[model samples]
Target: MSDKKTLQEIEKEHRDSHFAEKSMQYWRSWGSWFSWGSPVGLGLFFIETAVAAWIVAQIVK
Candidate 1:
């Protein structure tokens, strides 16, 4: 508690220059392998799965 001015009161003078985050957003930032490259991973996973299934079928048959 300052006798002259509180810290909150002093900060209020400069607060007009700052803006709040007003927009609610669902945003994708450009980044790594988990982004657009995920389909390739999924495709590879499916291919590996298919190969394993084929091997299993060959063994069973």
Candidate 2:
């Protein structure tokens, strides 16, 4: 371990080296799931509930 490097210096160096790639990787991973898959998932859930409600209505009537 180099005793000359301060904590802030080490942190700054690590952040500079990894921040962009790490941030981009995280955003890219979530972006597709949130933008596309979430809506599809929600739509399926809604349709399923609607169908259940229709079945209940038919049974009651």
The prediction achieving the highest lDDT against the true structure is 2
Cα TM-score of candidate 1: 0.41
| Residue 38 lDDT, candidate 1, scale 0-100 | 79
Per-residue lDDT over 1-61 for candidate 1, one digit per residue giving the tens place of the 0 to 100 score: 6489878887986674342322212223222333546776567778889999999999999
**Model 1's lDDT to the true fold?**
0.63
Which sections of candidate 1 miss by over 4 Å? Answer: 1-37
State residue 50's C-alpha deviation in candidate 2, in Å. 0.3
Per-residue lDDT for 2 in model 2? 62
Cα lDDT of candidate 2 equals 0.84
- In candidate 1, the residue pairs with backbone N, CA or C atoms under 3 Å apart (3 or more residues apart, or in different chains) clash, namely none
Lowest lDDT 10-mer window, candidate 1? 21-30
Q: lDDT tens string, model 2, 1-61?
A: 7679898999999998798889899988877665535886577778889999999999999
Q: After superposition, how far is residue 16 of candidate 2 from its true place, in Å?
A: 36
